[model samples]
Target: MVSWLGHIRRISLTPGANQALLRKRGFPERDLHAKTSLEMAGGSFIEGFGVAAQSSTAAEATVTLARIDGIRRGFAFEGAAMAMAIRDALPLGHRRHVSDLLEAADDHIYMIHVGVGWSFARLPRPLRRAAAAGLTDPTLTWLALDGYGFHQAFFHTDKYVKRQYIDPDPPVPTNHHPEYAPHAIDQGIGRALWFVAGADPNRAVRLIEAFAPRRHEDLFAGLGLAATYAGGAPPEELAELAERAGRHRAALAQGSVFAAEARARAHIAQPHTETAVRAITGLRVTEAAAIATQSRPSGHTVDGQVAFEVWRRRIMRRWATDDTAADGAGAPSTSRQPSTSRQPDTDGVKDGS
Candidate 1:
């Protein structure tokens, strides 16, 4: 475990630090070209494990694996062996569960240094903070995916000056990659938070609340993921943070469960899975997975991803309906809202870009 933490630390540092860590882990290469955040992370991890090939396709596979691991780290919280080892680790709570969003944000910043150099990194800190604070429980479900999509578009900008917001409705990419021309609605709001709050959680939430009520879910969810993952909110303050965004405590808990389940099934090592899931949701892995299976949308098989979404909606529907009624809130109508739907394989949430 100590050795693994060391490996993560090296990768989370500068690009040169990543190269050095790979060598220490017994890889032959002293350096490699990883031109994006995902690639830098994936490449460092894959190269350390001695699995990367010479082809671009092989590198992409490594990047995907690294991303899966990163999300798992977010879910694992203090249980994340590597993140816990960091000296400056920051903790954030989401109702029943706790996570280290600071570490997650550091991972992002580290990637920026590798892919876009110092200038780009200098400009994104505020945007990243606002995005984190602007999110809510329901919106978080999809905006987390939107962040992935945003990363794809953001990575393509070789120059910081080239960075521009894709309008709310973007033209579909020829390759059909959702992240390519990210739908600015979800991704746009998340990204805009940077200008509003920078890294200040308090300011971020205020900005998030200023959005129209119809957009509250998306804004709140995006803020939750970003704040919990990157904005450095203290654990004790999480409940207040949610309250400020006008999110119900129960809804926050449910969204976290979804985030946790999404992260867990992505990785093979289950060292922390049972403990983390039980701690957050009070259910063992097998029991939780079974519950997920029962909740599957009609006509959809109960895979990890499908089950995760199903359980998320089941928990969320209870709170959203109650909250909307109690406050006379005009949350998005039930008809078009994916959270209210039973389409087992809905992409509304997980479609990152």
Candidate 2:
């Protein structure tokens, strides 16, 4: 039997299915395939939240999540993670709910961490850290911030995307290494741009290009992940995205590798994943996944940098090296450095607040 609290949370927190509709989100209908793909992801997210909110146990919720097949299954697990985190953070709620779900859905750990970020976006300021308290994986916990960025960009399109507002004071844990928070959040915003542009490669490129040049690396990384993981674009479109990435191509390829690893780890396979991986990274899904795993940093931090960023840089460097060698350049550089050119600030773009 569902508790009164659970029932109330279900009704209050779960968004109506229509909320996932392109028209509802004010996103353009670029292509039928992209629209359907994004809407399906949104719907899966809602379903996951509903199932978790109403289920009595984490195991019960896991069974329901497992039934959601295809790549959409990952999104459902993400939603379920969000719901569990929210429940655990609420007053009088079970503190172990999020951790319990984590234990049950071990394979979806990455998506689950990202899902916890959704709770941060939904909860009151005081409860945000509480929601994150259960995450023990030091390296993966940063994904929650990525999720927070996605939530803000998806829900507050104008402020986060159009205006390109950066949070002056992000609501993160006191000791959560606040310095790298914006980059992680920007990665999420970049991912949201994939949905916002309706998976149109040209549109997505234009959106990322609108940001400051410095932000392009992380944004492109996010876009690569979305393009590969969510996969609405065709081979040609994927190729176009890769070409448009230019200097940030390495970042884009790195993100694709990350996405490939995430899907491979979760045991979910789709044709789009293969197409996107091949088009963007020139590697099979397995090859890209292997690269990501092999390049992963052993420690949570490396040389005073977040291991996650270090891991990403390592992947980017590998692509950079390969690209140089393929271009007949004598020796490959150690890294792909960001361009130093300044870009005109968009109308409403603000540093913070």
Tens digits of lDDT, candidate 2, 63-180: 9899988679999999998998888887865788788988998988889988999998888888887788888877777888889999999999999988888998886643645677
Error of 2 at 24 (Å): 0.5
* TM-score, one value per model: 0.39, 0.89
Q: Which predicted model would earn the best TM-score?
A: 2
Residue 295's lDDT in candidate 2:
77
What's the alpha carbon RMSD for model 1? 15.8
> Residue 44 in model 1: shift from native, Å?
8.4
Per-residue C-alpha lDDT of model 1 across residues 52-151, encoded as one tens digit per residue: 1111222232343355455333322211211121121223212110023222333332121112111112224433322223222222223233433333
Tell me which residue pairs clash in candidate 2: 168-353
lDDT of model 1 at position 155: 36
Error of 2 at 327 (Å): 18
